[model samples]
Target chain A: MILAATPGTATLLVELGVILVGLALLGRVAARFGLPSIPLYLVAGLVVGEGGVVELVTARTFIESGAQIGVILLLLLLGLEYTGEELTDALRDHAPAGGVDLALNFTPGLLLGLVLGWDVRAALLLGGITYISSSGIIAKLLADLGNTGNRETPVVLAILVAEDLFMALYLPLMAGLLIGGDALDIGLEVTAAIVAVVTALGLAVRYGDRISQVVFVRSDENLILSLLGLALLVAGIAEHLQASAAVGAFLVGIALNGPAEHAARTVLSPLRDLFAAMFFAFFGLQINPTDLPPVLAIAVALALVTAATKLATGWWSARQVGIDPPGRLRAGATLIARGEFSIVIAGIAVAEGIEDDIGPLAAAYVLILAVGGPLIARAVEPLTRRFSQLGRPARPRRTPTARGTTVS
Target chain B: MTEINETKLPGVGTLHDFESQSGGRIGVIAHHADRREVVIYDSADPDRVSEGVTLTAEEARTLADLLGGTSVTKRLDDLRQEISGLAIDWLPISSNSPYVGKTIGETELRTRTGVSVVALVRGDQPLPAPGPDDELRAGDTAVVVGTAEGIDAATELLTARAR
Candidate 1:
């Protein structure tokens, strides 16, 4: 039995097993502190990656492929989260807020990229990295804090939805731009990418019911198999057409609804989580630890500036919806974290060789915000109360009455 | 009736809230995954919840039943302890089902399937001991009690688009 096995099989199995167990432990540590697991996963990758510590030979291939699938699954599930109606409604109701968000957040990273003397393509990619907040982290934070029912939670969610919808357009355009060519070639490619996205969105809106019907099956196993198969197929075709595969997976997610969407979410969630972990870790693995020190200051400065801008955007939007001061603060604090999507932007740029510094900068930037955002959100309320007391005499804190229950 | 306001939480679910006559704010978050939470907002700050309580799917059902009226139908939990192989299920009426516009009497549900329709929920209202002439509409949920097999048979009959 031992001789029949491949030469390096035991080593491969052992390395993969060790890495996965490490990730599981890191996940538990994050959970203990009520924090998002993403930053820790990235840190784990950094520790084991090149220039840090031990390196894997065989597992590297698995991590690379797993990361690609992870990106696809991430975008697909993000798309699945919103219905067409929600997207349109959010765009209409909060378009101004979305505009403000883009302006406030995108400019900082763009400027940072330009100041560093990077190319326009790389600068634009940085702008995108700064623009999108992590809906995944924020949603989990709100639920954990019991703030889902808060008045300003919808405002926060609406902003997130608008950003995601915008990404549906931005990603394809970036995909085209990333493929270098002459001016005319780039223009044509970009147009084609935009057209593909538009056509996909239109089909999702018009024929989504039919698409869902085609994908849905009684058996959970078959349902996942078909959904996964369809996503990979569309992603492949889109990639072939110079449209980003992520956009195609996203469009696939947008097209599913009704019972099919529900079942798909149920089955795909765990699979998405596993692959997504690999994706983040792989991102961390790409950056050399030594490259991090030079860019760490810049990353810290960029995170601070963007966090402030996110606060302002959230506050303004909440005010537009007539939310009070405390609610506005909650809304602002909620949007401060930049997570998966930011890394995704940097990952694209890194893969395309946009700039050497981008990978380290983005990894450090995301790590700070991902860890700090939640702490800031938790602290905002107490800080405000403290400041209020300092300005005036302290009033007796009112104990919440349990008498709110209705007997009728 | 208090005016209930509904807000859509983009990636989460829907939130429906209302202010009580005493000026207290109460809300429910209905998650897409069938999870439910009851939240009471802080009187001092409407932006925060003073208390939040999560409910299991069954607990949510019981809460709805209690709010609507005293549920005369046997509680599933109580019945489970008393008998083996007995079941109670809440089955939804889909719009495409053939029985959507038909009266409860027309299906001959109890006579044919041995499953009794104990209560029917329409909109936010619960109808306990619905009469034979009561009409079944799309989106209404019917509570039925019987053996496990009978419930399955009844579910098929109610959900099937064709006889």
Candidate 2:
């Protein structure tokens, strides 16, 4: 009966179906290779996007927004991993390491931006893009590699939480700096964003348990719809307030606890999986494949330099926690991947007409690392063990044995 | 060996489809909080759930323990401590309790109750050999090694208000 509708509607349905089917096939292929599906999804988007083999005639707008939702969901899920108190504890314990992370990993891109002779604002944008790690990619990598319980993981996560805290601050400041004129306007915008973030976080910490109870319903459908609606509403409000929508979603996550948190995670995973793939693909869609080739060399060079810096940050952070050398290396290797946030930064820059080359450059850089990071993380374990054997004895060794027998 | 495939059900559980050695596919949906559902699938169409049953958290743990061994579940393992004379229990430090932000030593658990704080599970990280100075954060599960009477005393000591 629905097929009896207009040709335009039919076309829309057909395209959506085709894209989802394509993504599923690519995901299966990614499984075969034992690599992350993100790279494959990106390639799929490249093939189907503008300038690729088949340029889609319709549904770009819908896919684009879905991609935004994907980013919000990614950050939200990451926040659900810990309580506000734990985050606060981590902030206190790992503040110095977080500083180390920002200095080492963030400096390269800032320098590169200056070298490229972009404005101070653009350089800062690039630096922000480079500084934050992709929580989504790291989560997938941990699950795939079965490295969740590794001794270095807590250190890695601590660093990530610190990064998230920084991101909440940096994103608003960047947006303000990018948009406003003069010092006072910039200060006002940044201060307002920070206040909004703090208020949201405080409210979440205080009333989260109550909010979670109110949201949960006996029926599965109601619970899913309610959580989704709540996330969107909060994200929309945060966006309007000139803060990060993702930070808003993340706060919502931090507010929920115990059974509700687990329930939400279970309910949200499928939607997250679907939207997140599109988010990756949508990023690829924005890039011109032809433009990427020229910037490819520079992008790879940036990735190589930053990868090492990220590894250094990880190694330093993990070593500070007294994890053995091998675990330290693994920590460093895992942080190498950069995904959605970098692309988001580049997308904003392109939208604001900050710099023309950055969009393509960021695309190439992300592509290189998103694929390379996991590969290096997986390959590093044996290599590190071998090298550690050659070197002097380090701290007491801790081996990762999975804590529980999970059927799924 | 049990062959398992899974479909994650939103707000409900992860429905794991296990292929039995008899070539039958049975499904078990492990709920996030405290419930696990078992459903029989049709032999012809493994996707079609034929019959269903549900178990509470304790019931599920007991079932797993019965089928496998004592160490089948983490909570159960914590319940049935491997220590010979030293009984262990992962006592949750309740929120709003006075012990929420004090250290093991400050709580004076060992001195007052002769209980050794063996480990502390904060979120998922198990800090084995938690030191005297390790600050007890909210929601921490303190693994205490002591006799039954000593454990009751230690629990009282930790939750007791400052004099």
Candidate 3:
């Protein structure tokens, strides 16, 4: 009998299985070394990428599109977890110092991009992309380090919330500019976004309790389906309005925040996690190995500068706001990790042809940040302790509580 | 005398005792006196009580009453006592108020409001671990803890001075 060729479906199944197994093994190894598993996952993607021995993911467009969805869902979860009060608190806490941090990180990236002969739009995109610290990696590392309940967790979360809010506002504006759309069109888009958000909030306020009681209380399956449906519908509407689908998804998540919805998140989380993994894997597939060495060098350099600037800016801000030395150091170290959203911005830039060459660079930067950011965060405790000893007498230790614990 | 003698049982408080002893029990007792108890006894044949041992009219009536009524007044009273200590009062800072963006120490809030800012519920986040320098933002709901007068003063100041 003639040997049957491996069908695309079978090949995909085999590749996915191998990639997942490799990722799990690598993640375990990384955990043993006290590093976050995200870096391992990224490395695994690199191994199975086109440049590596195996070619598991060959379609860059499909992978990128899937990754984009992952980022949208990630942002939606973030919005769901935070409310207007929480968001405002984050802004207040970070506004005084985050402004400086943003400037320091953005300025260097902009200068570098310009020096490299990049266009204005490209330079700004690069700058903005580099300016953000990976909140996801940092938060994960903090939890891993058993600092999730630390007093500084909320502060770091607040800072991240501020950064994300800025990103949500900035992304659409950037898209409008690069699309060469008219001012009136952009204005109308912005107004429509505002109206959509208000309507979503109004629906949430009016019907949230009843909806939660029916959907979540009745059965978890219903809750998951309803939430997923809401996310997709909102994203679809956002696309229709020519705004970022991620922004719409985020607004829906924000509107859903309450005790009843919070309970339902646990059931829905596994699905989000699955999609999120696929998203990161897709991002990994987009890297062209031949372009990596030079891009990696730039990524490392930019990551270093961004981390330093973020730390210094965060520290100074915390100090200005009268945070203790330990608290400031913790905040500084924690704010250094950057992840999916940065890549999304880079991908957007590529899609719009604003600076096609910068996508790989931005992706490389995210990879570097994901790898190195956790290491810096892990060192914060020892560093803070050392600095606290050198400084004035340490402040009286507060008893640990749930509401404002510091994450590593 | 019979009622008094029948009121005591291990793990059975005044509420349960009253319900057991009366068809419909209703009464109050000192909080501390209602604490849980444990009973221990040695019996050659513990199950013999159900084998038709003769009992006086008083004993039969007490047992019958104990099986009749249903009352969980003790638990309800405990819940009430716990809730009484959790009074929360909100303070508003009016638009023309002088306390905008000021810290607790800067505003001398303790002196002016006569209430301790136990927590700050700003939007969706609650600052249960608020520091002395945590600046007050507009529309912050300060969870003040104090007497009625203190709560009123804090509320008035918040209303008068909040941005």
Candidate 4:
């Protein structure tokens, strides 16, 4: 065998290997620093991207397709874990607050985008993308801060779920507009999605165990293959219907949610992790450093404004719901991270070849969110505690118990 | 004074009364005194000390005397060990079942199923282990922990469809 065959293939392999290893190590480092690993992985991608050491993943259609798969899988898993009852409860409890938060963040983002001389559609897309709260990062931070057991976790989780649902609808709506798709086409796609979801739910109820036993109980390898096939099949169907593939994957996840599904997850987790890592890495690779400097300043300002708006919105709504000040702060802080959806909107604008000038600015905004999301989340607990103390009257403290006693 | 072989029954305990003593490995007497005589023990291999002849209390005491007082202690230990390793099985709720969309507390699952809900999985996420307030969704999978009888009850309740 030839030691090194094709130069193009060799270079691609080396770059891919190096980027993955570097990102993995950097991810560990980020965790050690008490930061979310997503940003670090993104940073690793940037380092190995065009302007950095080696460019492995080019800004090509195929790479975008792969990244899309990653997003679909991520959302699909999200859907799988979601129960309609819990989600409905969450929406009912937080809808007013969520709506208010949406308005507060989106209005300012829209005005800013307009002022910046961006296209109307671009402005709206940007507004929607920026207005979203980072549920993943916030949830992770809450767990890290040992406040997952707090009363606020559920409320905040609900809010995030509501926000995600909003984004799920909004992202496609924006994409449809940008891609020149008609309202009737969009409606048909949405209807198809609903029908597919309902069908999956019906099937799950009727034959979940038999299907799981037959598909997953055979062998570990077979289980992995079946789950992957299912994810891909659902995603493909969604794409064919002109609906977001992520939505289909999520529906599949929802359908499969149960005891047998748990077994399936454990086996599929490694595959999901690997693909997710690639997804983020691809995001990092797409950032063009030459266009970043001017965009960075504007992006940072927009991110701060969005974060502050969300914090205020989350806090006020939470307070209205009778949540304690500290809990509200925690919720507000956790809502700061944003990811793929925002970038996807920006990517659509770029792909349509309209408002190409703002593409760099949108990328910069994503980068800032990537960095700032974790910082805000990390600070939420300490900040909440400080604020809580300030609001409280001085009183004699009870001696603490080792196992932890509930506060009255 | 009596000499006992302590090495034969390692770490065995002595009984204060002779009636309570076990001649060999002590076993749970499963049947009535008049029926087929059998004892349940942890050991795969049990030693026999008697022939076809009926055993008197004195004869039993004499057999115990030969085996040493340690046999009784060893038998108790073995019985405890066997009971501890008993397995519990759990089944998932079928989608069309009435148990779906109900809370564990509302179901009176503990009383009916004899099995306690230890954990639940809905999709990819497991519920923060499970608690009373956590409602059971249609697709949720519950991990029930209990004895065989308890598990049997739980399975029946979980798999039962809406009336």
True contacts kept of each: 0.75, 0.02, 0.00, 0.00
Q: For model 4 chain A, where is the 10-residue window of minimal lDDT?
A: A146-155
Error of 1 at B76 (Å): 26
Q: Compared with the true structure, what per-residue lDDT tens digits does model 1 show for residues B1-163?
A: 3588999988778888999997889999998778999999876676777789999889998898878634434343123321587788888899988899899999899998998888999988999989889999999989888988888899999999865
**Candidate 1 per-residue C-alpha lDDT over A210-284 given as tens digits, one digit per residue, 9 for 90 to 100:** 999888999999999999999999999988988888889999998898888999999999999999999998998
Angstrom error of the Cα, residue A337, model 1: value is 0.5
For model 1, the stretches where C-alpha displacement exceeds 4 angstroms are A1-3, A384-408, B69-163
What lDDT tens digits, residue by residue, belong to model 2 across residues A173-196? 777787778899889998999898
lDDT of candidate 1 at residue A407, scale 0 to 100:
42
Per-residue lDDT of candidate 4, residues B1-163 (tens digit): 1222111100011111111234333321111112121222212111111112224545555656787967775453223111463434435567887778788898898877566887887777877568788888876777666676666677677778878
DockQ of 4: 0.01
DockQ of each: 0.36, 0.04, 0.02, 0.01
Q: Identify the CAPRI category of the predicted complex in candidate 1.
A: acceptable
Report model 2's TM-score to 2 decimal places: 0.71
All predictions: root-mean-square deviation over Cα? 11.2, 14.2, 20.7, 20.6
lDDT of 4 by residue, A201-240 (tens): 5565456556556655657777777887888997787667
Report lDDT per candidate: 0.88, 0.78, 0.63, 0.62
- My TM-score estimates for the predictions, one after another, are 0.81, 0.71, 0.64, 0.64
Model 2 chain A: ten consecutive residues of lowest lDDT: A142-151
Extract clashing residue pairs from model 4. Answer: A76-A249, A76-A250, A80-A253, A80-A254, A134-A337, A257-B123
